[model samples]
Target: MIKWILILLVVAAVASLLGYHTLAGAAATGARILIGIVLVIFLLVLFGLFAVT
Candidate 1:
């Protein structure tokens, strides 16, 4: 689970960077926001797993 979270984080980071580098448009901003949300959710899950263990 932790590993999955790490993978997700990396993907999110890459997506965020790409979105930021892309032209400032609605699509880019939308993508960035979506990735940010996904990253946060994954981080929360990782923390939950740690706490349970």
Candidate 2:
């Protein structure tokens, strides 16, 4: 998941450099959403609301 976020960010950067504004925006949005999801999951685990074996 973290890897995906990184990949998306790279893609966004490249797209922006190439002047593909729409693609860049989409990739950036995807990265932002994944970051939010990861943050929420991390918080849940930290507070013991989620269990891991």
Candidate 3:
């Protein structure tokens, strides 16, 4: 799950960057949102892991 979240976060970040910087359009909004969600999930996982350790 953590790995999945990390992968998603990386994908989202890249997608958002590409969509906005390269493509440029409303499509970028979706990518940005995905990036935010993935980042939140990634942070949650990190927090959970820290708590466990």
Candidate 4:
């Protein structure tokens, strides 16, 4: 999931550099959404680990 996000981010950067505004925006949005989901899951896991300890 994180790898996908990174890939999408790179795609976004390259698209932006090539002036593909629509593709860049879509890829950027995908990366942002994936990052948010990963962050939320990470926080939940961290809290669960602390709670168990």
Candidate 5:
């Protein structure tokens, strides 16, 4: 997931640099969603609401 986020971010940056605004926006949005999901999972585990086992 982290790898995916990094990939998306790189894509967004390259797209933006190349003036592909639409593609950049989409990639950025995807990265944001993945980050949110990761954050939520981290919080749940921190609070002991999620079990790793």
Candidate 6:
């Protein structure tokens, strides 16, 4: 998932450089969403709500 976020960020950067504003915005939004999800999951795990038996 982190890898996917990084890929999206790179894609966004490239798209922005190429002046594909819409594509870049979409990718950036995707990256933000993924990061938020990851952070929430991480917090859950830290609080022992998602413990691995």
Q: What CA RMSD would you report for each candidate?
A: 7.7, 3.0, 6.7, 0.5, 3.0, 2.7
Best by TM-score: 4
Which ranges in model 6 have alpha carbons more than 4 Å from their true place? Answer: 49-53
> What would the per-residue lDDT of candidate 2 be over residues 1-53, giving only the tens digit for each residue?
99999999999999999999999999999999999999999998887854554
Cα lDDT, all candidates: 0.63, 0.96, 0.63, 0.98, 0.96, 0.97
The parts of candidate 4 lying over 4 Å away from their true place are none
lDDT of 6 by residue, 1-53 (tens): 99999999999999999999999999999999999999999998887854755
Worst 10 residues of 3 by lDDT: 20-29
Clashes by residue pair, model 4: none
Task: Write the residue-wise lDDT of candidate 4 on 1-53 in tens digits.
Answer: 98999999999999999999999999999999999999999999999999999
Candidate 2 to truth, TM: 0.90
Q: Give lDDT: candidate 1, residue 39.
A: 82
- Scored by lDDT, the top model is 4
**Whole-structure CA lDDT of model 2:** 0.96
Question: For candidate 3, what is the total of clashing residue pairs?
Answer: 0
RMSD (CA, angstroms), candidate 4 = 0.5
lDDT computed for candidate 6 = 0.97
Q: Which residue pairs collide, candidate 1?
A: none
TM-score of model 1 (CA atoms): 0.55
Return whichever of 1 and 4 wins on lDDT: 4
Off by over 4 Å in 5: 49-53
Clashes of each: 0, 0, 0, 0, 0, 0
